[model samples]
Target: MRAVRLSVVTATAAVAALTAVTGCTEKSSSGSGDRVVEVTATDDKCEVSKKEFPAGHVELAIENKGSKVTEVYVLFPDDRIVTERENIGPGTKQRVTAEVKAGDYQIACKPGMKGDGIRQNVKATGGTVAKRDPRLDKAVASYRAYVQAQADETLPLAETFAAAVKAGDLEAAKKAYAPSRIGWERTEPVAESFGDIDPKVDVRADGLEDGQEFTGWHRLEKALWQDKKIGAAEKTLADQLIADLKDWQKRVGKAEITPTSMANGAKELLDEVATGKVTGEEERYSHTDLVDFKANVEGAEKSYALLKPVAKENDAALVTELDQQFAALNTLLDKYRADKTSYDFTSYDKVGEADRKELSDGVNALAEPLSKLAAAVVAK
Candidate 1:
């Protein structure tokens, strides 16, 4: 959802390796120790400190020295994402911690947040990744089930939206739009892990690559709400949307899910809300930003709930803060709707600037504490 361009690979090629994480650890020529890699991103180069290091808990200390927003990725040979941090704004620094086994990988930086990005070959030499808590295992398993369920539930709803689009029923398609997006909004990072399907199904008009045709929900959304007609082109795009999503449905079970990734992904969801939903950039035509906003919160909360047990045991104070912040944000969101349980909220455009500022503040409050979740779960 953060507009990271990864359409270079065909969807078929992307789904070829459904599993992103490997169980086997390679023997490292270098002995096991903590590895911290420094990355400097500029307009033209991706500078990684070391090309090879022992694998285990590797931390990327990244600084965006460039003038434009950038994204950094640790990718498998096949371009499957190991872990990534997107939307690294200009002149900002972020530290990302990921567990890796011995393997060959590439560290890439997309200066303008587009294309395959500048790449450098890096190797995780033989080293053992430390064992995780058994409770963390349960968290991973439950989160995987939750991710898959969201994917399963999404396809049917998307099909309903596509059906209306195909039938040229403008009103029905409009009504189905926000509902179809809920599941995807909740589990977007899982969808994005594939590196191909997201661009196919969710790319916005401005997010398109050079010579890439725009054909997704937003395209259809534009036609229905802005262009005011569902013509043959719209119908064809509708079919494409469903086909792409069916591919996503098939691949959700194979995505890489870890406690840290869940925690990281939850933060990414909040970033998504802050950048897109809060700014009214997403759902620009339909004015349904609040619906997507709610879905994003729901997805983040689900991940937090799964990891809460271990996190609470590790850092009770952080857990308490997270709980308080989440409640405060939810309470703020609830004011937009008459019924708290439903997705039917006031359109984003109708919300005043004062209200939008409050929502933004609420997201920041929760996100600050939520950022500590991964470390909490990984604590000894």
Candidate 2:
């Protein structure tokens, strides 16, 4: 599927509403002094008093007057340096201080929301204010909870979708598919975990009543849904669909294992807060898991690009190599997950450090060469 560019129309509407309620004036903080920026969130939008601040330490005071959970993100041009406040629940306020350099900057809110996207251009003058948002701690807690709930909801939905297909109930399957998709769609941060399953195939069109029947597993589902007879042809199609789903499940499961497992471990650590037992300090490798997963993804993406034409031409060698690469990565990920969960963090100080280091190194090794191969293949 083609990637859709994010729209800022909702953001504009949000900004307008915020501007009106706050009655705040925009001023130039470009001089050699600390500046105070006030930002507020409303039901329909987020508003900032000013767009630009001086190039220095700037303090942002964020207040949540809206009924829903709101977050404020300050984005740098590089896209890496970001400061965000999450879950500033209604009637709450938070503040964060960031060192601002003289460059283009934006203050954006409700990043993933459809009609709540708001961004304001800010120009920093000179000097900076070093203030921290007291509400940030709570916001992080709220965000973590939100992510956990989303994961819990998504897993079961995927299972149900598979069951719907197994039962040969197209209508039931169609209803089930959307809720299952919501789990993944709402959790956009982990959307990349699904690997090469085209969104167009799996999520968007899988259970639709549309007349167009595509290829792969979804086509099988369409056959079961539209075809009335449960004869040899249907059975053959169903069997093929099941086989394809199993393959897809393996890939999707592997993708979920690394990130979801890490998240699970992290959640356990957070849960242990009441007991004051933060085990696996160095052993916890969430960051490493993400890095490795990203590398594998890049490699797979590369191999796909390179092998597409060859596979189309019925080049067995290219297809075989691609399969091997995917299988190897899949095996590595499985082993890493098993190793990670083997040790009881609470029992040992080192926890899974050795295993994590090994996994990290393995991922790094795979990502580099795979990326190169994929780039070469695509180039050819």
Candidate 3:
């Protein structure tokens, strides 16, 4: 329960012992450099074997010595999560590798897998300067431009949706909702970068927001589809949504996007479909989940498109598999499109139970291969 002070020799020996016991070399097991950091996570805190290290490739072999399920994170300045592992049960160990830049960062241990997390500062000093791969640099530039284009498209459509709501035109507002959301969904990471406005723009009605009034797309959907009317109160939320989106456009101008992040984003969008869309929780009121599903896939597809060149060059077989999976998954979804635009999109509710299961299976199939993309891109 007390703070631990592990000497570097002890930590090094511990890792070496672990390597011997598992019959694995540290570098091979972690895809990390020889430098290892033992991060011991407990019920309420995290203990680092080393308070500092030279910047570059590092691995944190996390030992969850906690009583409950927990997650741990290596954070950049201002608490941007760099890499994290979740759902580590009691007495389990998980390894997370990160290519860290020279800076001060924090270790966050969330004992319950939810919270701001208990944090402790750690430093990375000068070392062999980590150089960016030109391919990854090119991918990052392309992804950023995509986000900018999506944002540029989103603003005006948001205006139309907001105006329709203010005018009490439920039919028109409903028409505008899905299209407006496409650009926003494609730029999910950008929405997240703005912090305060993300939930306001996209939070589902679920209690996840800690009772934050659920004033986003689902909120507007309820007013439009369920109530069949948009009152002044509903119009206020619409105005705020547009306001937040415009703010996101400005803030995202300086935001960063990396290949690893791109891969994570793609995986996360698929995860969203599996966890939320399939369950119908996200589109509880309007059953607009098919719209969300399509958008998530589109966003991920764009990321994959950027990585395609590097992926093809390095792991041509894997790229071919992913390409095939994506095509199959899209073919499965194209069955539900009644037309070319969001205007004629089919609701997830219209699909029979069996058909929905088929969609879920298809998404998982793509996600299985898609999950390997980030590593391939990084390894390349």
Candidate 4:
């Protein structure tokens, strides 16, 4: 559902909330440590009570002292976020506990959730903490459950969407299009296990080989929105989409989802949004890029959540960072949330370039930390 790795320059350019220097509700999977550090955040500063520690399981309490919204993060030497907390409005608070090795680290704060905030160094004097999370297996199991739920949800929606299209009811089909796609987007890694089915249904115009017939969603999307009509061929395609989705549901039900692949799937889904949705390519005719954008985020979020407990066991700071980043990104996407389920956004064609750039930047910021999720969760 995502992938990202932000360089120092890239982090500065996109800003938003990220990195370490905050605290929160969740406890590290590893037992509590003797170390407790308090960090306070101002609009322009991240102040830590201590800069050096023995670094086993360290407790961090990050409070927003700024008048505006703020976020905190722990960053690696490479400037990647190790942990973070977001949207501490006014005087809210967050906390985290993490295990670490003896090394140089940085704490970055984003005030107003804009740009990279101030970064301060943190030192760990002890050797690396060992990885031994009992929850690791449960994490993978939970992710499988989430995928299964999405798959089951998609079955009926797929039928409804395809049925409307086959009936030449463009309006009904358009209405059904988004929800049906949500299940597929969320369960993509599994659904894609079907060699020919995924490409047949999900492949975009860019993936279309010469003389290869354009089929699937985009193909039908054109018929409904651009042409504003559906013909016999279009109806036939709708039926095939249904069959493909059904087969996908059946096959994916028997598949295994590992921690790394699930994490990778989440990252890939975000890539779909960054490259296609942000650029206004997906659902071009309807300008419903945001719809897919939101769905992709849901998929990625569930994946990260599944791996979170184990990640916390190894690198609580990273778990915190991911939680905050995901929240910030979801909040960003929620701006488009019109009702309980849908977005209020118009097509990208109607959105200004600056706004589009902002969206792209935000996506990149989240992607950076998200890319690290798999490795963090699966480490032994």
Over 4 Å off in model 2, which ranges? Answer: 1-33, 76-81, 127-380
| Per-residue lDDT of candidate 3, residues 166-272 (tens digit) | 98888899888888888777767545543356666676655343435667777898888888888889989998888888888877766756676677667667866
Query: Cα lDDT for residue 314, model 1?
Result: 92
Report the lDDT tens digits of candidate 2 across residue range 65-141. Answer: 77776656565432322344444568878765555566666675652222223656566765443332433333334
| Top-down TM-score ranking | 1, 3, 4, 2
lDDT per residue (tens digit) for residues 325-368 in model 4: 77877777766666645555555577788878878988888887
lDDT of each: 0.84, 0.42, 0.71, 0.69
Which of 2 and 3 is ahead in TM-score? 3
Evaluate model 4: give its TM-score.
0.63
Q: Which ten residues in a row have the lowest lDDT in candidate 1?
A: 18-27
TM-score-superior candidate, 3 or 4: 3
Q: Write candidate 1's Cα lDDT for 20-115 as tens digits.
A: 322212222233234778888888778777778777667788889899999898877777777788888999998877767888877878889887
TM-score of each: 0.91, 0.32, 0.80, 0.63
- The candidate that wins on TM-score is 1
Off by over 4 Å in 1: 10-33
